[model samples]
Every structure is written in C-alpha cells, then in structure tokens.
Target: MKILHTADWHLGQLFHEYDRTFEHQAFLNWLIETINSEEIEVLLVSGDVFDISNPSATSIKMLYTFLREATAQNSNLQIVITAGNHDSASRLEAPKPLLESSNIHIIGTIEKNSDGSINYEKLTIPLRNKLGEITIWCLAIPFLRMGDYPSVANASNPYSEGVTALYREAFEFAKTRMSDNQTIIAMGHMHTHHAEISDMDKTERLIMGGVECISATAFDSEMKYVALGHIHKAQRIGGKEHIRYSGSPLPMSFSERNYKHQVVIFELENEITSLKTLEIPVTIPLLRIPLKAEPLENVLVELQQLHDKNDFEQAPYLEIQVLLEEPEPALRYKIEEVLKYKNVRLARIQPYYPNKKESTSEFNQQELLHELQPVDVFTKSYQAKYSAEVPEHLMELFQQTLIDVNQTEA
Candidate 1:
C-alpha cells in the first residue's frame, strides 16, 4: 500500500493582505496530478485544514472541491483528515457522514459514547487495500485539547501525560486489531520535543517550558510511521526517521521562505516500508531585498534592478527592510516609485534603527499610572518606541487627530 502524509494546508490564507487563491489552487491542481500519477492508496492530512477556525465560505468550498476531485480522479484513494488548533472541530466534521461514504474519514474532535467514554472506534481506522484486505491500522488522533484525553489528576505535566496515555491506549487497541502482517501508523497534531519551528514564526505557539510540548517517546516503537503536523518545518523528531512532520504546503511566514515544503510518501510491501519526499514547487516566490536590512538608498538601488513581471499570481511577494538613522516620512513614496513598474507586490516595510534599546520584561504599574493626560501617555510611548521625543510636527498632527476624535464623540 502507498500512503502520503501531508499537513498544514492553511487553505484560503491571505498572504500579506494579498489573496493567495491562485497559489492555493495551483497546489491543489498539482496535488491531484500527483495523486493520479502516484496512484496513492491513502492520503493523510494531519491537521490545520483551514487558516482559521471560522473559515471563509470560499475556503470551505475549496476543501470540498479538492476532496471531490481527488476521489473522482482516484477512486481507490482513501483520505483521513483530523482537525488542528486552527480548526473548529464541529465545523470541520459536520460532513463526516457524507464524506465517509466516499472513502473519506474526517475526525475533528474526540467523540464520546453514552457514558462519556472516549470512542476509540472513531480514532482507529483500518486501511484496506484494493483486494479488501487490511494492510495497516491507522490511529487518526486529532489535536488533543483540555479534557479530550483521559484525566491525569495531579500530574506535573498533565498535557503530556494525558497525550501519551491516549496514544498508548490507541496503540494498544490497534495492536489487538492488527495481525502480524499488518502495521500501525499514527497521526497527531502536536509539538514534539526537538522539532524545529520556523524562525520568528508567530503562527505556532512557542514551547512554553514543556507546557504544550511532548516527547517522541509518546509513540510505541511498533508503529511504522508517525505523521505529525503543527510545525511548518519538515523534519524528523528525536533522530527517528519514521516519526516526522511533513510541513506546510505553503510558507506560513517570510522567515519560512527557504523551507523545502514537501510531503512524505511511504510504500509498504511485505512488511518493508520505504519513505521519500516530494517537494512542492513554489507557486509565488517570497523576496527579501538584499537578504538583510539595508539603508534606504542601498535598498532602492537593488529594487531598481528587478525586472517588471506584471503577471498577477506570478509576481513575487516582496518585503523591504530598511535601516534608517531617523524616521523618513517619504519612505513609502521612494519604495513605490522604484517598485511601481517592477510589478512586485510590496508586502511589508521593516524599518530598523541603530543603537536600539531592548525592551525589558518588568512592568512598573505605578510609573505606568503616573501618566494622567493622554498627551503624556502618547509622548512616553513614542519616546520608548523610537528612543527619542516625538517631533513637533508629528505632535501637532497627533493633537489635531485627538481633537477631531473628541469633537466626534461630543
């Protein structure tokens, strides 16, 4: 049986205020072709089907259309999807009854029985081949939340302990169902220890002192493959090749521009499993001018070197990093003039200054409350951020804006 592991589609994502519909559609098209060509038997989407819990109607339609197309193209293909942190469990699994009829299993959240016991049947799925013979048993566990797993009262690391306990229970159940010839595979949307997250990635929650992190030992060695999501960087966890994160199809942030976004493919035959990676081609490139922050003059010179490519989706997304001695009000005009005809979409302007003071974590409540007037509050904030007093003209503008606001309220 041939199985493909992919996660973090983040469908209907808006990249830097620019609609990424074209890019996402391109990826979907490519994925359909791959499924047809590879004749993949099972497709495992670990989690994060949509960008947000409440996705736009267009995103929902895209997902359904992909599912329809995938099934129509390859009738033998089986898809199993689970919900992630960014997903609304109930919403994602609303069409479960209908989807299952077409070989699609959607497990968004834990389902309980009459007595409120976890329904292991919903979590464990059997992957059968063309001959109607069970080849592998899959533990389709979704992102675990509070109360989802068995209660581990008074445990130091309750989250990790509960997660491990759940996996063990599922693994043991899979073992009971599987024969000697069959293997067990697990899917989890979790942050495992030693997994590499993209630099400056604010999308994924940081490792808060092992509070939300679990170890690779959570999985039993009997499992053949562990498909993980939540982290956008594709990597093997704990030096083990089988336990891996397939990574996001698209770069979640500019910092992930260099990520080799790919899906993992595994072929199992006669108890031998062979795995490989299929890299997804970048539909729209992300450009960071000069590859580092530079002075406005230097950045403008480099921006001018770019040739005009006006193709809508083909035009690369750009981020400009400028080093400034002081604030330049004409910064936008300068960049726009250079990139006006370049056809590159300017996404962000990262301004950096020299002799920056690092912010401290300590908070002085008394000092904070000492600013009685709105002007004093604004002045203190401006000075703290810019490391200098607010300019006279800017201060005048601020006062005028405040006066207008006050008048409107009156």
Candidate 2:
C-alpha cells in the first residue's frame, strides 16, 4: 500500500500580510499532479486544514475545488482529514457525510461509541490486491479536542499528563478496531519532541495556549507509522523509524524562511517498505533582509551589501531593526528611499542607544502606566487600596473621575 503523509496544509494562510491565494493555488495543482503520478492510495492530511477558524468564502471554494479534482482524477484515492487548533472542528466537519460518500473521511474530532469502542473513528482504509488486504488504520486525534475525553478540564499539575492519559485511552480503543493482519498508520496534529521553532510560530503560539508537547512513545507501540502535524518544520521523532512530521506545504511566516516545505511518501509491505521526503517549490521567492542602522549613511551602506540590490526597488518584505543615538525624520526618509528596493517593506524599527545591549523581553512599563493617566494621587491610592469587584458602569465612572483628577493635577 502506498500512502502520502502530508499535514499542516494551513489553507487560506497568509505569509506576513501578503495574500497567499495564488501560491496556495499553485501548491494545490502541484499536489494533485503528484497524487496522480504517484498512484497514491491514501492522502493523509493530519490537521490544520484552514489557517483560521473562520476562513473566507474564497478559501472554502479553493478547498472544494481541490477535493473535487482529486476525487475525479483517482476513483480509488481516499483523503483523510482532521482539524487542528487553528480550525473550528464544527466548521471543518460541516460537509463530512457528503465528503465521505466520495471516499474522503473527515475526522474533525475523536468519536467514541456508548461501549467506549472506536467505531468509524478508526478508518480501516483497505489496500486490496490479489495477495490479500493491507489496511491502514486512520486515527484522527484533533487539536484541542476535549470532548472525547472526560479527564482534561482545568486539571492540577501539568495539563500534558491529562492529555497523555486521554490519548492513551483513545489509542487503546483504536487498536482493538484495527484488522490484526493490516498495518496501522495513525495521524494527529500536535507538538512532539524538542526541535528548533520559527520566530513567527513562536509569536502566534503566545496568543494561543502554547501548552502542547506529547511524547512520541504514546503511539510508538500501537502503530506501524505515525504522521504528525502542527509543527511547521518536517522532522523525525521517536528515534526516526516510522514516526515523522511532514511540515507545512508552504512557508506561512518569514521566520520559516530557512524551512523547506515538504511531504512524506511511504511504501508499505506490512511495515513501511520505503519512505521519502518530497519538497514543495515556493511559488514566489521570499527574501528577508535585516538591516541594522544607527545613521542614514550606515543604513545605505548595509543595504548595498545585500546580494540583490534591486530587491529594495522590488518592495520585498523586510524587518529593519535600527539602533540609533537619535533617529531623525530625515534619516527615516533616506532609509525609505534606499528601501525603494522593489517591494521593500519595513517590518519593524527597533531603536537602541549606542554601546547598550538591548533586553528583548523588557518593555516600557512606565510609559504604559503613564499613558493610563491616573486621576489624582488619591484616586490611584484608592485603586491600590481596593480589591473589590467593581461593576462595568462603575468602573467607567471611576476611570472618568480618575482622568478628570489627573487633568486637574496637570
């Protein structure tokens, strides 16, 4: 049985603020072509089908078109999909019944029967030939899905223990459902093992509950191969045997500039016969140039040092960190001109004093406090003294009184 393990599709994703629709379209085309050429039996999309919880209508259409084309091309091809935290399980599972009729199995969340047994949850996709049957047990462990298990709500100690226990129960149930002679191939979207993380991913995780790191040993015993998603980088976990993460199809962030997007292909003869990684070509070139400048002249000199000087005129997306004693409007103007390298985007302006090491974690706490403009010293003193819950309207009145007192004091 030949299966193509790909995950973290992140459809409708944006690279920086740039629309990735065109690049996504190109990638979809490439994926379809590869499927056709490879004569793949199963296309396993581990998770993160959509980049956002609520995707645009156009994004939905793109997915529909891709599915239609794929199903039409290969009557035998089976597509299995699950939802990552980025996607709403309900939204992703909307067309589940309809899609299943077309040989596509969508497991947005774990489904358990009253008997506590995995039913249709373990997709026993058959690879039939004259020799016998080789079945792949498609196990979908959705991201942030707590409905399947009862033990994971606001638990004491590390939440991972609860998560691990839930999966163990689920995996134990899934194992019983799979055909004994057939090989089991499990799929999920989550973090596993220690690995290098991208800057953009790090930023996004901050807003989302970044508490996710599962040991690979959880699935090591039951399944022959485990295909994971979530993490953007393609990696081998659990001692690099059959467990692996097929990274996102494209670079979703500038921090992933160094990562080459790819998918994993496995040839199975009971156990995985052969496995190979395929790289997806970038539809558009992504160039990130960090220019540090204390003065306008220094900025220009650094810009000249870039390999493609014309890239400035191209308005390439950029992150500029400036360390200056005094950054003037004039300097900003000259920097903009030099940045006229085509499509040059000023991502960030990080100003620092000369001979001072910048503390990346520290922020201007005093400025934030002053911006609040506490009314009078008495009002501030009152706030500090009180710990009682105030009503919304009362809070508003208090804020206004404080502002007035602050103005009066000024």
Candidate 3:
C-alpha cells in the first residue's frame, strides 16, 4: 500500500495581507496529480486544515472540493484527517457522517462514552486496500487539550504525561486489533522534544510552548510510521526516519522562505519499505532582498536593478531588511517609494539596530523618570508589578483614563 503524508495546509491563510488562494489552489492541483500518478492508496493529513478555527467560506469550500475531487479521481484512495491546534474540533467534525461515506475519515476531537470514559475505539481506524482487505490500522489522534487526555491527579507535568499516556493506551488497543501481517501507523498534531525549529517561525513557538513538547519515546516501537504536524519544518524526530513531520505545504512566514516544502510518500510493502519526499513546486516565490541586512542606499540600488531584470507578473513577494544606526521614521516610505513601480510586492520592512548594553554604573532615577513618556512610565510599572506586558485593551483603557484626567484639569 502506498500512503501520502502531509500536514499544515493552513488554508485561507493571508500571507502579509496578500491572499494566497492562487498558491494554495496550485498546490492542491499538483497534489491531485501526484496522487493519481503515484497511485497513492491512503492520504494522511495530520492537522491545521485551516489558518484559523473558524475558516472563511472560501477556505471551507476549497477543502471539501479538493477532497471530493481527489476521492472521485481515485475510488481506491482513502483520506484520514485529524484536527490540529488551529482547527475547531466541532467545526471540522460537523460533516463526519457525510464524509465517512466517501471514505474520508475525520477525527477532530476526543469522544467519550455516556459514563465519561474515552471511546478509544472511535479513534482507531482500519485502512483497507483496493481489494477491501485490511492492510493497515491507523490511530488517528487529534491535538489533545487539557482534560482531553487521561487525567493524572497530582502528577508533575500532567499535560505532557497525560498526552503520552493517551498515545500508549491507544497504541495498546490498536495492537489488539492488528493482525500479524498488518502495519500500524499513528498520526498526531504535536511538538515533540528535540525537533528542529526554523529561526523565523514565530507562530509555532507561540502556539506550542516549551511545556507542550513531548518526548519522542511517547511513540512506541509498535508503530511503523508516525505522521506528525504542528511544526512547520520537515524533519525526522530523534533521528528516526519513520517518525516524521511532513511540514507545511507553503512557507507560512518569511523565516521559512528558503525551506524546501514537500510531501512524504511511504511505500509499505508488508512492513514500511521506502520513504520519499516529492518537493512541491514553487507557485509563488518569496524573496528576501539583500539576503542579509544592508544599508538603505544599497537596498534601494538592488531593488532598482531587480526592477529592470524581473517582470511584475512573476515577481517574488519581497521583504526588505535595513541596518540602522538609529531609528528612521521614514524608512517605510523611502522603501515604498523605491518599490512603487518595481516588479515585487513589499511584504515586510525589518530594521536592524546595534544592541546597546546598559552599564552597571549608577544613574539618576529622577532624570530617568523625567525622560519617560506617561505611557512608557505606566507600561514599566505594570510590567514590574505583573511580570507581563500590559494587555493591549488595558493599555487603551489607560490612555482613555489619561485623556479624561486631562479634560478635567482643563
């Protein structure tokens, strides 16, 4: 049986205010061709089906349309999709009854029995070949949240331990149902310990914090292949080739501009036989000018040269980085003026400044207080007291309070 593993489609994503519908559509079109050409039997989409929990109507349409078309193209192909951290479990699973009829299985959230015990049977799915023979068993586990896993009261690192425990229980149950000739595959949307993260991928870090990372040991030896999602970088965990993250189909951020996005193909001949990566063709390129920080004049010169050489239609999405001795208020305007008639679309402007270390010498407290703005002073006070940045809404309320106080004084 041939299986295609992919994740982090992030459909309905707006890349820096620019609609990525064309790019995503092109990817899906290519994927369909690949599926047909490779004669893939099972398609595993680990997670993050949409950019947000509540996706736009267009995104939802694109997802269902692709699924319907793919299944129609290859009647033998079966698809299994699990909800990622970005997905709303209920929303993703809303049409489960309809989708399953088409051989498309969706495991969005954990189900429970009437007595509140988890229904592990619902999570385990059997994958059949063209002959309708059970060839493999899939433990389709979605992103687990607090209270979603088996509870360990008073345990240290309950979240991590609970997640591991859940996988163990599911895998053990899967073992019971598996035949001697059948292979077992597991799917998850999680951050495993020691997974390499790209420098510029900020969203994943913010979403999967340090506490959420689980050890690779969580996956036992019974599993033949572990398809993972959540992380945007494609890599094998703990140097095990079978445990892999297919990564996002497209570059989600500027940090991933140089990343080679691809889908993984697993050729299972009885046991897992061969794994291959088919790199996705770049529909729209992401260009970071200067490749590194440069002076404003140098950046403008490069942009002008690039304008003369490249056509607008095929131009890459551009991000400009300028090194600065001090803050330049008109930096954006200056760059925009250069790129106004250029071929590229300006997506970001990053200003780099030299880091200045504060001295250990004594300083005047009164002078520091006098130099700070009212808002800055309040921000510092709030941070000192709470050890967190003031929330944006609270900061707005503080500004309004200042305005009211000024009016009363006047």
Highest TM-score model number: 1
Q: Ten consecutive residues with minimal summed lDDT in candidate 3? A: 355-364
C-alpha positional error of residue 199 in candidate 2 after TM-score superposition, expressed in Å: 1.9
lDDT of every model, 2 decimals: 0.87, 0.69, 0.87
Off by over 4 Å in 3: 199-203, 206-208, 308-314, 355-409
Summarize candidate 3's per-residue lDDT along 200-306 as a digit string, tens digits. Answer: 44555445467788888999987899999988999999999899999999999888887889999988857777789999999889999888899888988888876
Q: Using lDDT as the measure, name the better of candidate 2 and candidate 3.
A: 3
Question: Which model is ahead, 1 or 2, in terms of lDDT?
Answer: 1
User: What TM-score, over all chains together, does every model reach?
Assistant: 0.93, 0.77, 0.87
Q: Between candidates 1 and 2, name the one with more favorable TM-score.
A: 1
lDDT of 3 at 384: 45
TM-score (C-alpha) between model 3 and the true structure: 0.87
- Report the Cα lDDT for residue 84, model 1: 90
Q: What is the C-alpha RMSD of each candidate to the true structure, in Å?
A: 2.4, 8.0, 5.8
Stretches of candidate 1 above 4 Å error?
A: 199-203, 206-210, 270-272, 360-366, 370-372, 392-410
lDDT of 1 by residue, 124-206 (tens): 99999999899888999999998899877798898899999999999987888878688889999999887787764445555
Our tally of clashes for model 1 stands at 0
